[model samples]
Target: MQFAQFDVAAFLNAHWQKRPLLIRNPWKAWANPLEPDELAGLACEEGVESRLITSGGKQGGGKLALERGPFAEERFGTLGKEPWTLLVQAVDHYVPDVAALIEPFRFVPDWRIDDVMVSYANDGGGVGPHFDQYDVFLIQGLGRRRWRVGPVCDAQTPLIPHEDLRLIEDFEATGDWVLEPGDILYVPPGFAHDGVAVGDDCMTYSVGFRAPSRAELAEAWTAHQVDAMAEDDRYGDPDLSLQAHPGEITAEALDRLHGMVLASLADRDAFARWFGHYNSLSKYAETDWRPEEQMEAEEVAAMLGEGHGLHRNPAHRFAFIAAGEGVLFFVDGVCRECRGEAAQLARDLCAGNEWSGSPSEEALALLAALINQGSLGFEEED
Candidate 1:
């Protein structure tokens, strides 16, 4: 499906941090990745996470049922019988088709791309009026849902029925619409909205945006930088003089300390590389297996020279190969060039797929070495 040619850059620059705008049928003849039956089956799986919430009384008052990860289908049976909704988070990473549905939106920064959450609802199923802290694009995939949204005026406004759900108290609808399959709704952070399923079954895909607070960024980056710093560089006073200003941290000293931390992340290439690696790492659990034995270098060289393809493990996010004078690695949000043949093999591994044919001899050799080192293993592709 071709997406609507909206000026995304302009919209992001203008309304991204400002207001909300709904775009109708953003994609042509939009199709859902998974069928209802497939979704139901997935909900029943032991490893798949699922939840059901029930609401009663009115549009604003409802009871919520909060469940954690790895839910089985039997758990949801007989629950949320009426006036309730079922929401499943991180559906994209599990379902390739759903992941593809969100790929077109990569025009937005990857860091801002959160998981695709699918919500299934029965007749009268609706989560009470509420506002989200992050921007989200709601696409109606099946059946119909009624949505109402209002502008946010305060950040500290108390919301949520329990510690888990954040429901708004007084939500004045600035807009009201019934979403049919293929219809889209864009709600910015703090816009209050309520959606009710109008029929027996309804599904909505929420493409959420990530809004990392300043504190969050600082915390993550600081830890990363500290780990990369050299040992024996701890803070200390070399010229100790007896003075009465023991509690005072001088501005110059504070500035120096800040510089030291910032210096670790100051290199543009380093920062990008780490961010890319961090972003690509899988958040889901990986299957376990033992590594394969190492192979001969000559055999590997022959295979690589034969143009054999190399592939990465679906569950492995970061892969590095030693190149000449440096190591080639992909991390955080960027890629880095490393020295030696190992780096070359790593690059080859990062680029290959099952369809790309067999791994080159050189790549095989390197993989064998990594396997021998217990750094990698072979897991059947899902």
Candidate 2:
């Protein structure tokens, strides 16, 4: 569904990350996507990450409850009438309906987009008051859920220590409202909030965006660079000036070393390529995305000749960035260089789920590789 009526620029300027905003029933006709039974089925799958939280203690909000899932069907029946919630992450990767929820919000850059996490809750059910390190758009799907948003929280904010979950120690709601179907709440990073199902069949789709910490960037990027660095590519000074104190490293030597380090990290080209691969890494990295049999270049050409296009796997993460004279295209953690028509193909794949244009030979090769990797599929496969 296209958000042709929504003001994208106004929302970004006013509430992207600055604060929270409530958009009441923005869609013309908002249809609930996944049913609770489907969500429960997904939770039972071993490969899918899920959680079951049965709130206990005072008002059913305490540290005494929570369980990881791959649970048996009987477990749902055993939960009883107690307040509980089921949360499944990256639902978009598995369900096309859930993935469609991300399309409307494409006003934001594609690289910034994460995944859709769907949750089902019973009356009085909640994950407890807490803050996230990433921005999220909470869209009510099935039933009513009363949400409470408090003051902004940060690193200093105290959390109730638990093995599975980190909940706020104490929270006071500054604003409370019940969200009906199609309503949306935009919560920026580090804001405290809680949501409880007003009744049964309550479902919420959380479209989240991540903010990589400085420490994370340093560790991951440095690790990538270290592996790629040559052994002889070490600190070298061709002309070293003598110093009065031999114990003290000369400023010139230190300057050369620092310059080398800066030069390595500040290589925009290398960083661009690295980031394309880095950000394209799927949340389900261990889950293989390869097709059973790789399609040949001839088959691809024939398909394109027959007016068939390319489609991206819902489970794959695809993106591209303009790098110097060419483009760096990334799909499911693999990076490829693109030029000419191939570059346009990369951009098209990133922007849309399907591609219909005639493929150049170079584009055919890249598409074949992605198809073999199981991230790109022929339109006829649909």
lDDT of each: 0.67, 0.87
Tell me the deviation in Å of residue 176 in model 2: 1.1
| Candidate number with greatest lDDT | 2
Best prediction by TM-score: 2
Per-residue lDDT over 132-248 for candidate 1, one digit per residue giving the tens place of the 0 to 100 score: 778888889999998988768466776755777777767779889999898888888877888889996799989887777778766876788888778987776676566668898
lDDT of 2 by residue, 109-186 (tens): 877888899999988889989999899999999999999999999878888888877788889998898999999999
TM-score of each: 0.72, 0.93
Task: Please give the TM-score that candidate 1 achieves against the real structure.
Answer: 0.72
